[model samples]
Target: MNLFADIRALVLDAITTLVTEGVLPDGLNTDAVTTEPPRDPAHGDMATNAAMVLAKPAGKKPRDIAEALAVKLADDPRVASAEVAGPGFLNLRLEPSVWQALPKAILGGGTAYGRSDMGKGEKVNIEYVSANPTGPMHVGHARGAIVGDAMASLLAYAGYDVTREYYINDGGAQVDVLARSVYLRYQEAHDLSVDWPEGSYPGDYLIPVGEALKDKVGDVWLEAPEKVWLPEVREFATAAMMALIRDDLAALGVHMDVFFSEKSLYGTGRIEAAIDALKEMGLIYWGVLPKPKGKAEEDWEEREQWLFKSTDFGDDEDRPVMKADGSWAYFAPDIAYHYDKVQRGFDLLINIFGADHGGYVKRLKAVVKALSQDRVPLDIKLIQLVKLFKNGAPFKMSKRAGTFITLRDLVDEVGADVARFHMLTRKSDATLDFDFDKVVEQSKENPVFYVQYAHARICSVLRKAGAEGIDVSDATLAAQDLSGMTHPAELHLAAKLAEWPRLVEIAARTHEPHRVATYLGELAADLHGLWNRGNDEPALRFLQDDPVATQSKIALARATAVVISAGLGILGVTPVEEMR
Candidate 1:
């Protein structure tokens, strides 16, 4: 089904034949040989650097090997022509029938045409959007959620067993501040004068949590001291915030398989166990770290503390595990959390962090390497900022979220599909501008609308063909004669469809789901381009005077729809059936 892959196999077979005929030496390593789309389409349909890679090893000139291999490749029915370009590159132009058959393949396979088994069912755990359980999820967290969710879906399409996770950062001073903020709201509910402090969150979102606290305990905790009320209020507030966060994620169609609480690491021996495992490997030590860069010398304080020998694993410096106060440092719990994931037998670990967490990436990787003894690999993707704009101006904060824009607010303005699609228009590490007007605009420049329009247009085509008394069923269309589809416009679309399986494997391998979005945009453009050209050339239209010819064209349109649906599935987006 993968034409590029099939063609590459043909190339390898030809190389094997060259070896058998004694034209090429035996024991030549062909692993470096690759067959891919030529950088310039004019060069040919597919190009390989086989001759360039093997000439020196085979003790032959590059041009001599390329010319010899060209003859063998041209002998195949699939290859229309093979030319030796430049000094050694072999460019092959496949028979038009090769691309013409893609529509049949797409119709037969449906959305499963591009699915890959590259991961081999390897278990992968991806932790993302682990915002603190102190407030509603902001737009920043929305980017992480979309990227992480899309990545999980992408890996799954590539045959990886993926588990989505969210780490609850509840065991910190911020949650304590959240508890005090809720207390103020609780007092306000009781008609008592409450002073708003500097460090407390004063968002209106917490008002409901405060009222709930008042209804639960009445006046029981009204007279209780700080020590007595702090723990209970903290637990209550944290749970309420978590509930709100869950609702926000649900609105955006994001769901986590696991919600790990940082509090669970404390008083549970998990942190100590992870550290001890590293200690047994002689990675744990006591040391004083130097003053860090980007800080004034006077602001730097030196103290001896327990450190992890992360530098041994190529980290810039050894990281501290415990403070001088004997309490676990900030990095200790994270190490333990990832260590626990590695011990659970996950083949791969991925963390989706914010741009601010870029500095933490190296140390986290080092610890996972040491903990897993280099058996498990850890990958961290840092999502950059999302800048929101509307009406040619920067968007303001959300009153519902108190200080910043919430995920729900964004979804309310634009539906989940638009938000998800727009968020992934750029790479995760690149700063993305989310223009409300542009995202909802029904123009080709707006990729979200453009891609969706292509799917909807294909649906329209199917409807019209069905109304004309043609058998538009998938089985009927797939069985049509595709040899009539030799137009350049039709062939161009088929060629793009052939790239789907390869694109999925590439995106999955690089841990970049944005590539799927990019491919979908390009595919949509090609589909649209073909449709627009039909205005002048009546033969290029989907519906024609001949039922047999019409069915063949519909088969191509339906095939395009299938790939579009599959691509959107990886992006966690619903394919549009009709345009509004």
Candidate 2:
């Protein structure tokens, strides 16, 4: 249960009682009231702003109200003490039983311990890793994939119906380059030497695609003109590239629920319909944009081009939907794709884009606002660049990828779990330095290893207890007398455990999965801190000479392990059962 929520209800109930008993005037708005962990833990378990927020509105002094409220709250069995702190902030101390019951709640809830009803089962569509379908995914795409997948998992745990999606950029000019690159590979497969000229993809990853094409056709298109082979080859090569991308994603434990093809936007009335919808809302018009502000400006030509009234919805300027040549601009298909998502009846939409796409955010949000009439909210998370390093220097580029570090290379170097966890250790908006040596280091400073070591430490303790015939399983330890677990250091762990459910809600509400990672790090630190303490103080040791005491202490440590496993499950990281 959410103790903070329960306490807030108690405060609200007391306020309602005060109003009904004529202690306060009627019609006082309590919307601004909040209950949260105080800035200093010594103040109390929680602090409420009910009196402070209601003082001016109720035409009463905050201290006067807080004094009365404190007495009322302290009378409840759940509240051990209530003090009116500075400026009438009500600080609350909960009974020790409240903190002691946390482990039981964790055991009962299992993986659902931190799950929230915040979204109320609302449908959310998350689109990420929509890299150009020209080659295998690279390091940059890995970050987007992990963030998006973890976010989807977080939202789902928070009670949102989430759909993980990928939008293939097959309709762009990049795919045309991909087609020509594959043609060269096809020619090579036919024993003809071909030069991969500038502007062509020279990655050896496509070598197999070329061979596959030859295997399927068997020289049928060997002597054909461009018209005879380009169309079929383009389709064939695009499929092959998508397959390679899927395999790369699979290697990192990412799976998409939907794969939307950009090419589908063409040869259909979808783009026209999306533009028409905007037009009906008076958001579509014909316009010309200004030239570059700083750089050498191109010849400023006044031309009538189809544009969206994005400025009305907070864009820098009106965005183009159709070019003067009657072909759709790049933004046209994106708008149509988001429109399709809206029509599919999602309550929320999230797009994970590379940091370079920061400029596109406003226009995209504007289109969603204009089309969905502000019903569906869109949030764009920009993933910053990942700088890879090895041996204290920059890692060399992948010869297979030709110019960038492919996702497979990173996964092969470090397993999928490490790649995913390390990618999320930094905030999505912050540039991350992926030091190959540091992340894999077996020290407390390494987050991935540190967290995993906490889990492994618990495992080691359990094994030690078992070998000594202490019977330290969950069933045995849970049955032990835990009344001796009253030390401040021990109780402090329970206090941190109490924050997990609230932290999950906060992270999910803000659409920041990195918060979960940060929380996990803190939890692991606290666990390790307690473990290290046991070394200096034998009384703090988890496995004591007495089986009963050992069971109680082991119960506490195992509970920490359970919570860590649960948090890692949300992050899609596999907890290490042992530290090798």
Candidate 3:
């Protein structure tokens, strides 16, 4: 039961009545009308812009329409008062019974209380954390993983059929480099002196791959030529690195539904087919691109090559699909990959990329648009950097990863729950500073702990009420008369609880999972505020002398806990029943 949505519907109904009764003109567009919380809660419970948005279109004064609409809205029993404020805005105060019944709605719905059907089961593919198969996932990948995973979960909760995917980069030159690095380690396993090259991977993680290769092949490839050994070693090393990466992601509680291969796009007719689809649309051509700007004249060269007309789709310049050497450019296979996704019939495609990939966004979108003929929408979210700190000092790099901090290192330090929750405290496009010292703190300053503590506090309340011989089950509390929950604090918390279903729909539509974390923090604050107030006011306490009053208060607390658990579940964080 979304009270805000219900109120907005009532407002719309009143506007329709006004139009039918000749108080307002016909054919007025009401799509711009909105109902939301008033800026200052003292003004009213909810506010609407119905009169402001419709006055000019209906050829009427804003105040005159607002006053007439107020009279109609006030006739409803649910609306205690509808007063025109600010030139034409309608501020509404709902009856206490509306807020009082919210707890029963929450208890009835449980964790599914905030689930929405906004997407209507549209198929959505979210691809993220497609880290290179040459190494373990680093800190940047961690942020993208959490954001994408949470987004998939959020969209699913909002009734989207979501598929979590990762695109493996094994077809690139990096995998060849990984093959050579593993060959050096294989030589080292044979007790031979191997000189490490400047571009070779020096991480100790590759040693095991080398040892495993030696054990399997038994010096057969030790004396083979580059052509014979390169493919075998590349295949072997890629598999091992992917396994390591899977372990790292599992450590951070991220699992993918699909792992697409970049190599699969090569040698197959897929690349040609994707380009042909664009060619049929007159988007592909053989032309010479102009020399790029800002480069030295000596570095610039004009060459006729196979190119895609990406400029027509709002890109800065046309992008090449093939080079002069007859080799596919980096963007060619990417276009083919996204074309494969479009062919699979996903209604929407979402790519979560690191901030460094900002330049690739426009070109990628252009290809998807040209291939899908604007039928499919692609949304690219760029995740900013994460700077780690400990004890007020910048954290150091990991030797195991050989360059940056590994995702496993982060999960080991803070655990999966803390890491996932903290990573979502900021938006995907905003830079985040993760301080180990601050995140694990038990104080209210730590949002994860504060929210979990609220849930734990509710559990403690239920236990206390149970020990006092009061029935505290959801079935019992839901049947109790909650009219005694008339205190302002009690009603405010219930009102906040009513916003969950609305917030879920908003977050899903915006494709922003951080809003869930933000709302959960606000809800936790309300729960904590009411719990603290009970210390001085005996009537506010959960366990009261009267069984009916006690059940009503416990019902409110349990409802709040239900929402907290549901929100944390979307974030892939486990809510604790008791804080240690």
Candidate 2: residue 123 Cα off by (Å): 0.3
Best by lDDT: 1
- lDDT value, residue 48 of candidate 3: 94
Q: Which order, best to worst by lDDT?
A: 1, 3, 2
- Candidate 2 regions with alpha-carbon error over 4 angstroms: 295-298, 468-476
User: What's the C-alpha lDDT at position 13 in model 2?
Assistant: 89
What C-alpha lDDT, on a 0 to 100 scale, does residue 426 get in candidate 2? 87
Q: What TM-score would each prediction reach against the true structure?
A: 0.98, 0.96, 0.98
- Expressed as tens digits, the lDDT of each residue in 1-580 for candidate 2 is 7788788999998898888988888998888888888999999899999999999988999998998899889888989999999879999998887777776666655566777899899999999999998998999999999999999998998899999999999898888889989989988999998988899998999899999999999888878888889888899999998999999999999999999999999989999999999988888878787764675646555678998989899999888889999989889999999999999999999999999999999999999998999999999999999999999999868988989999999999999999888998989999999998998999988999999999999999999988988887666665666767776777778778888878888889889999888988988888888878888988888988888888888877888888889788888999998999
Task: Give a tens-digit lDDT track for model 3, residues 1-580.
Answer: 6777788899899999998999998888888888888999999999999999999988888999999999999999988999998789989999999988899988876666888888999999999999999988888899999999999999999999999999999998999999999999998888888999888898989999889999999898888898999998999999999999999999888999999999999999899899888889999888998877898889987789999999999899999998889898999899999999999999999999999999999999999988888999999999999998988999968989788889988998899999999999999999999998999999999999999999999998888888888888887877877888899999999989988888888999989999999999999999999989999998899878887778888999999988999999999999998888
Candidate 3 clash figure, as a count: 0
Q: Where is model 2 poorest over a 10-residue stretch in terms of lDDT?
A: 292-301
lDDT of 1 by residue, 389-445 (tens): 989999968898767888989999999999999999999999999998999999999
lDDT of 1 at 116: 90
- Candidate RMSDs in Å, in order, are 1.3, 1.8, 1.2
How well does candidate 1 match the true structure, expressed as C-alpha RMSD? 1.3
